[model samples]
Target: MSAGDLSGRRALVTGAASGIGRACAVRLVEEGAAVVAVDQDADGLAELAKTVDVEQSVVDLSQLNDVDRLDLAVDIVVNNAGLQHVAPIQEFPPDRFSYILRVMLEAPFRIVRGALGHMYAGGWGRVVNISSVHGMVASPYKAAYVAAKHGLEGLSKVIALEGADHGVTSNCVNPAYVRTPLVENQIASQAKAHGITEDEVIERIMLERAALKRLIEPDEVASFVAYLCSDAASSITGSSMRMDGGWTAH
Candidate 1:
């Protein structure tokens, strides 16, 4: 999509305080979309709002009730909020598992359901859910995160089908390890869980899983999502675009 196409469009991005969500929000504004940024970090959200024409809101996506207010009327909704709590199934806390599912899967569903209502009313909208390569295939010690991401992919598909008639397209981007603060934290957690160094976690656990053997840049993922949000992607709903560096191809 071109800058002119997004000039008057309004975009709401969850988890917009940092990492992929922040990058996506910044890119959308650059593309000329009016942005509403949502995150749990009030300070971070404040920092982001200063630079852009952003309406900032503090939200804990894990609570389903948060969606009541998240459904701000907008032309685009990017469900980029998620968590990575790494632990073996046997050792994982039940509360942590539920927490991951709530934020990564359930919240996205609520956001999409609410957004679709507005989208249907307007007759044009884009729903972009940011998933992960773990949604396609998994490794050791990321059960909850993997399950939630996998579930999110399924939810996006259903939304795509149901929203089709209303001219609302739903799609997901399943990216490989991106060098964002979220993934940095995940690497640290993995290193701690598996008794490996952080460097080893990135080189062995993350890169080894990717054919590219490198971390994906946030902009790479953001660009694809921006495209999906465009009129050019009108026929691209109900699809999972893999930015996984051929990890699933193997």
Candidate 2:
């Protein structure tokens, strides 16, 4: 199918307020898809709705009941909502750990489950999980985040296998650290955690972790996600597309 073949199709994106979610929503609309933008930030959702033909919903994805409340039957679901907490396993708060899993893993499961009947009846659908390079490798101070992402990858693969005959494809997009507000805030967060300056956090922490020595852009990840959701990606399922700039190469 052509790049512009998304006309009349509907897509729902979590975390649509900012970062990769915002970029993906914009890109999907540009390719002719009607979008449902979901986020906890009502202000951000309002801004996003003004930019496209989007149905905006303000819901906290960490709550399973919130996922159940979405009533639309869309052609695609992008589970992009997530959180990052930095702490050693010994220092990590149990509540924070639970929150991360609920948002990153449990919520995706619920959203996919809720969309299944609709997708199966329609005979076509796509589920794109916005995972991370941490999903593939280990990182210090990201215990809960990494674990949830890893679980999300495994869950996507299973859905791909189970949904194939029904014409529903499930896959993941794993990108290295991107230059989003989330990552930018990490400069301060990591610096405080490590007792270093923001410059040191960027140079000695983040850049050092990446092979490319550069942070990824949200648009780059968005384009890859948009491609995966397109009809051209029909043959692609149960796979992890790495946009990690070779971070996992080592």
Candidate 3:
């Protein structure tokens, strides 16, 4: 499908309050999809509502019961809600690890489960998971985030395999460090963990593994996601598309 070809499509995007999620919501609306924006931040959702014609749901995704109860009968599902906790495996809190899994892995599973019936009946659907480079590679002090993202990668592939015969496609978009509030918040923690200055965190740490020494823009990732949802990407499923600026190429 061409840009703006989603005239009648319905989409549900989690974490749509800010950053990459917000960009994805805006891009989908521009493509003529009616977007249902979900996030835990009421103020952020309110702000997003002002800019786009979207239905809003303010709920914490880590609440597994609430996640399971969500209305997910949409043509497209973007599982993007996530959080980070910087600590080594031995120092990582058990509850925090569980919470990350709940939000980043289990919630997507629940949402997809709720939406699959509708998608199968309608004969079309898309599942786009916003994962990280950690989903494919390992790093220090990010045990929970890495584990959750890796689990999501597996879940996305399983969905792709199961939905293939039903016209539903499931894939992941893995990005490295993007210019978002999440990364900004991580700067201090990363610096502390690596025993480096904030400047070094960006230069010698974050961008060190990437061939391109720059933070990715949210819109850049969103544009790639938009392409994956189009008819042009019909044959691309069970794949992880990297927007990591060559981080994985190393």
Candidate 4:
């Protein structure tokens, strides 16, 4: 309840079996908050549970019904589950677009909408959405992803204004191309889509816009998320915190 610690807090983190979500689960636990790890990957959740004492919820967030089934009474909600599809706008499949938005945007909206009551009652809470650099800007061949992130930013802002009096802060952490399995998969997809090698995808495409010239590790982003969740950042609501390696500096 105080700055720098989460002794009695409970956090619900989606996509928690791996990548940034996994790192967040570990870090928040280290900060003393109990975590409920949610993901569609049953095997990965089992693996994560083997290492940490977390309640595992194996639900496909794309399934709105399953999202509703989740125990929504928690002090923190980290909406980090996502996927990407790279294609020119004209070639983008309508179904894929809808699917991405359902998982990335609609699911978060539902989770936060359901969880707000408990947070408001408790008079304290945090909603840390793991958005991407695309949330602030855009890139070719990622129409659906870009749209979903953009929507997420707007959702965070609205939540901030409404939750301010209730002590619930909603914010987005925008990082550029993190070193995660998702990004790794994107590299392969990009390489094929662009007719280049994976190394070229990383160097000439992914890192091209980033001044840091390297991928961001999941722990680094997770650390920032933990900070936002801490009492130290009670004033930092409805803000988009970018860890984009100066990608937006352009």
Candidate 5:
């Protein structure tokens, strides 16, 4: 597609300080969209702002009221802000679980709700949720993340059905472990939790299910998001596209 395919469009991307969200913001900007990059990391946001022409919002999405108050009237909304807390259900901290749900599930709902009216009025919008393989299947020790993503999957489909007639499309992009700071930070914890060395964590735990034994790149996922917002993807809604390197093909 042409670089200016999305000229005149505006997009809101949560968790835009880094990782997949940052990549999405950069990609959309390259495609000629004005991006509103929202995140709690002030320093990261500052760096991102210098790299791209985007409006930076230093807001914590875990605060639902703050999310509700944001100006969400944009043509594209990417619900990519999420955190992972791994522990057995019996041992999981209730507060952490609640916090995860609030950020990952409730925040997305509010953001999408805030933007839908504008989308319907304009008769065009794209909602690309950064979901995970956990959205489709279960894995051990990720009770909250799994639950939130599954809820997001359902939410995306519902939005798809409700917005289809209005020219709005909602979909989820599920990727296996992406090479991001989030995943890198989890290496030590995962190794300890699974009783393996850190070196073995990626091969044994993260990439074990995938035919391709490597972590996905942030830009690769961003490319998928960009395509979903393109004219070519008009008919692709309510779908969960897997960039899992054959993980789900099993």
Candidate 6:
């Protein structure tokens, strides 16, 4: 879509402070959408606000009560907030699993639930969920992350089905592994869990499933997100678009 395609549109992007979330926020704004950039990182949001005119919302997604309080009446919602804690299932902490689910799955539900009325009333909306390859498949020592993403995949489809008559679309963008702080931050945890060095975690673990060895850039994923919101993609609802560098081909 061009600059005016999303003119007068308003978008809410969670985890908008950095990484893929930041890229999506910037991309959407470039297309003339008024964006509400939400994240727990105040400094990072300040940095983003320096270059783009997006409303900043500094709130933790893990807090359900706070998530419900967010002004979610918007035309677009990008559910991208996430965290990773690598550990075997037997060793995984219960609280961590709940926390990840809260941010990745439950928070999206709340956001969409709150926004659907406005979208339905306006007869137009887009919900682009930033899911991972793990949403479709499995990986060791990532039970919570995998489960939450899988749940998101299901929720996206449900939203697409229910919102179809109202001119609303919901889809998931599933990337194999993007070069973002979330992936970088997980390296140490992955290394410790797999009993390997950080370098090995990238070389032997992260890239092993994909045919491409290089990590995907944030802009690349963000580009696909923007495409989904374009007029051209109005028919592409309920689909899990995999930008995984052929990772799932195996």
Give the per-residue lDDT of model 3 (tens digit) for 4-113.
49888999999999999999999999999999999999999999989989999988998888887778879999999889998878988999999889999999999999
Clashing pairs in 2: none
The reply for model 6, stretches above 4 Å from the true place, is 1-4, 188-200
**Candidate 6, 1-250: lDDT as tens digits:** 4434798899999999999999999999999899999999999999999999999999999999999999988999999999888788999999999999999999999999999999999999999999999999998889999999999999999999999999999999999888899888877777987899988998788899898888899999888899999878889999999988889998
Between the candidate structures 3 and 5, which one is better when assessed by TM-score?
Answer: 5
Q: How accurate locally is residue 9 in candidate 1, as Cα lDDT from 0 to 100?
A: 86
All candidates' lDDT scores? 0.86, 0.89, 0.92, 0.94, 0.94, 0.94
Give the Cα error of residue 40 in candidate 3, in Å.
Answer: 0.6
- In model 6, the Cα lDDT at residue 15 comes to 96
For each predicted model, how many residue pairs clash, with residues at least 3 apart or on different chains?
Answer: 0, 0, 1, 0, 0, 0
5 versus 6: better TM-score goes to: 5
Structural similarity to truth (TM-score) of each candidate: 0.94, 0.95, 0.96, 0.96, 0.97, 0.95
Clash pairs detected, candidate 3: 1-231
Q: State the lDDT at 172 in candidate 3.
A: 98
For candidate 2, the 10 contiguous residues with the lowest summed lDDT are 1-10
Deviation in Å, model 4, residue 199 alpha carbon:
2.8
TM-score of 5: 0.97
lDDT per residue (tens digit) for residues 1-250 in model 2? 2345788788999999999999999989998888899999999988888887788899998877878999658889999998899888999999999999999999899889888888899889999999999889988889999999999999999999999999999999999888888998888877887999987887787878667878889989888888887778899999999988888887
Instruction: List runs of model 1 lying over 4 Å from the truth.
Output: 1-4, 189-197
Selected candidate, larger TM-score, 1 vs 3: 3
What lDDT does model 2 reach?
Answer: 0.89
